[model samples]
Target: MNLPEFATTRTLNNCPAPAKLNLFLHVTGRRPDGYHLLQTVFQLVDFSDLLHFEVRADGQVRRTTEIPGVPQESDLIVRAARLLQNAIHDRTGAAAPGADIAIEKNLPMGGGLGGGSSDAATTLMALNHLWQGGLSREELMVLGLQLGADVPFFLFGRNAFAEGIGESLQKLDTPGLWFVIIQPGVTIPTALIFSSSELTRSTKPVKMTDFSIASKKLFGKNDLEPVAARQFPEVADAIKWLGKHGDARMTGSGACVFCGFTQEEQADEVLKLVPNRWKAWKAKAMQEHPLAGLLDR
Candidate 1:
């Protein structure tokens, strides 16, 4: 006989860590500590990488993926689990339950999608309930901040109006619009975009009131788009191709370009016309993250 493990004590193991699109990004200032001050509204997409975790009785946190260019010791998920474990031990005086994390790579590296941040959030959320640590969202988010700037947003698991170096988050009333997301098989180093001499360090911040009532209309331009186009011609090409059917913009300092479509068929039609070499995915808008849906009783 075979059976499904419906009575398992685990919470979120296989979770979706979606990519985010910054409707607009502005570098307001630079801190004395060297972290830049930023203001942006991060729109989370349904597209995501899958992270799976299995509880370990042996009490060890580990990663099963070899993320190219990312050191194992510095892996955000591992660091996040360890941090939570330490926090739990310090607070409750119990050895934290452990897990082996498996990351299914979907989002491209250096694509400005916050893939690492999302993974860290999932790890924290899953472990909190799995170990019966009884942590609130506030507590989890605090732990998340030490992992990365963007990790806290995913802890909330919704599209948000973010500011102050992407830590401050306010959930938005965003709509469900399909997207034709394309990656031109190129990796654009985020450091290059931020550090480029031509990068816009000074840009006026736009009021949230300026945004459209629906997600279909373009609220404003992506400040990183022009610089990214100049750095990677492939991104420019993808944008141009996607632009023919709908409004196209680069997500983050991306190698990935996205165009919004009111209808799935419209995006599908555009997909047929796109070159085969580019990595493309058509995803519908999710008001709540997949993990969020799973969490709700």
Candidate 2:
């Protein structure tokens, strides 16, 4: 397989595309364009899906597996690669050979872990190097944002404070703390959350420092939680269970619930106490994205 001079010299071939958790999500309003306005902090976690690339002669981007519920063509990874190719071709007068991208899915789908967006970000970043496009990281991030609001943050690839549909990003120096993530096995359609009449449409913006400290209270509930809990009782049950461990809160929209703690041991203690019926994991928050370490080299 052909690779960049730097990548060719390295032994490791795979890139780590990490997942994100919305430390807390607030639906502030809806735009006239039908997009939801949001304010939330995107926290990168050690948990991730592995993406392996093999350069191909043909310029066709494809995924190994159909992402369970998402259509192949509509998948973010494909769209992102196509977007990058278009952007680079338009600006640089050339395009890179498309690679067959394979993803080892570990993160749960529809759980709001940003798996799809992360995968898309990996596609753009990896191809930018693997194809030898020589695009600046900032330039790639700009192209990524057009793929999805979450895409830019994943491209930034770190702990970030985000607002305005989650495209706006501000990097933060959050310590590597531990988290307990619970998935209740129910898929809460994102559209349902946004379309719900009960969804909050107005929330005053809070300062970053003030927001970080206030997040400890978990007082500002996820606006979509109520509609989700009504549709899926198991989600509420998972939240109730994790709440016993710490200040349990829902991530984007619904379904997955998380609680942050100071130590892995404490998170493990809570993990053991959880009922065997629900799926859960204990992961440390990442100061930098797992993929950043790969790219930096």
Candidate 3:
């Protein structure tokens, strides 16, 4: 990977934080610490949230944009920047720089699209480059895991087959299919779905080879979907409506349902027919993160 053209710039604008779809998620088991063991293929999509960062001379990390219901301190992007700033300071024995981050939110919160995680990963990568943090992609990934399990995958920069609470990843080539995503205007809490008594915690684990075969037919299912659908009727309605076109399924936990199409035209056709009540769009699969090249610096 080569360094991006913005390597020398102090301000990185319109930086993309792409969303991810769990093509298939299975709860294979549970860890003793209460974390669920998961098996899933994280497919990157063009749909994304944009972030802008300006280096701050005064050494104070700040978010210029305010997000409804999310406080500045609790925002993952802020946490990621501060974490990297501290790490760089510790490594170099000098004061690390700060940044002013502004987010252009596109992906819905609680929709299981991995928006927050992607934003945080983007912050770590962008600030690492702007501040000359000198952290390798692997080191950044290790730092990201402290924020969220899905955060490391955004930094991993490739579509992958994930296991072990979604941190253990192996590069996987997914089909270059287009997707029709439907957001049912409801937010489903992941914790609520996972904690449900009806949630399934045991699914037979399969190999990457198995996924290779199954990908051709879109043959896996999201185990948390049932729990989420039962708790939120809007999710079930969206799934039922989209299923008419193909094998529609909920990604990650809930609220958003999707169906794949081999052609962009086919995806657009379905996207048009989506109920006016729900938010719908189409995005082509991305083989790697747009900022994957930034790590080369």
Candidate 4:
């Protein structure tokens, strides 16, 4: 029999990569590099994708399993391992470290919840330890950034208030509220939304101190929502339905919509009211990533 997760999830060979919700996403501006500058808050959720790593002695990074549509070379997990391997080789001239990575995915792709970025982050953290790379969080984060903008924040390992293309992070004291995240069973194309002429590129920047302790709960809004909603009716439907229970917003450039509740029972009640056609899950916010201390914070 397979041992339950909380009981055995942190074993030597298996590691957890938690999912995240963008409590709010603001497109502050666009960089000359063609990347969009963003101001957002990243909240860790209990929902996660678990990775099981088997180290390869001969220095070959590989994935033992397949993610239905993603090819092996293109998987973020694979890319992360290779990126670290190359960086470690350059840094210390040590034996190139490698692993056969396997995934237990729970987070949905294109749901705007940072599944791919978290997977890549976990690969860097896990392989860094298993292969004895000995790189600090500082080193790992640089390699993480090459994988994706969001990768570095997962390596930051906290609920953060982010800015500057999502890398500049300041830890936030946000509440760990219960979340009712409803997946509208649609895959949102982030690129499509970003390129649309309808997207508002300017949302006045807010100081972190602008919100009082009591007002923090009311401050989240996704600037991408209206654009996404216009393209995907399912997204609009989810936002409208979830908003009935609590203030709801799209997480990231989302196809998934979520609302917060102070009580688990309150979230559970709203979760029950979700239309049967949609997929949904109840999760609690995580103050820190599960693999947080694998490397120094």
Best by TM-score: 3
* Arranged by TM-score, best first: 3, 4, 1, 2
lDDT of 4 at 167: 86
Clash pairs, model 1 backbone? none
> Which residue pairs clash within candidate 3?
none
Predictions in order: lDDT: 0.78, 0.77, 0.92, 0.85
Tens digits of lDDT, candidate 1, 1-297? 011122477534556678877766777766777677777778788778887777888888878777888887798889999998998999899898888888888888877788888888877777776787777777888889988888888887788877777888888767677888898888987778877777776777756666655345766677778898998899899988888888888887787888877788988988888889798888777665556533342
Which scores higher on TM-score, 1 or 4?
4
lDDT (tens digit, per residue) of candidate 2 on 48-97: 78777767768988877756777879988788878878877887787657
lDDT of 3 by residue, 1-297 (tens): 122346347888888999899999999999999999999999999999999899998999999998999999999999999999889998999888889999889999999999999999999999999999999999999999999999999999999999998999999999999999999999988899999999889899989899998787686799999999988999999999999999999998877889999999999899999989999989999999999888985
TM-score of each candidate structure, all chains considered together: 0.91, 0.91, 0.97, 0.94
Higher-TM-score candidate of 1 and 3: 3
Score candidate 2 by TM-score against the native. 0.91
User: How many residue pairs clash in each candidate at the backbone level?
Assistant: 0, 1, 0, 0
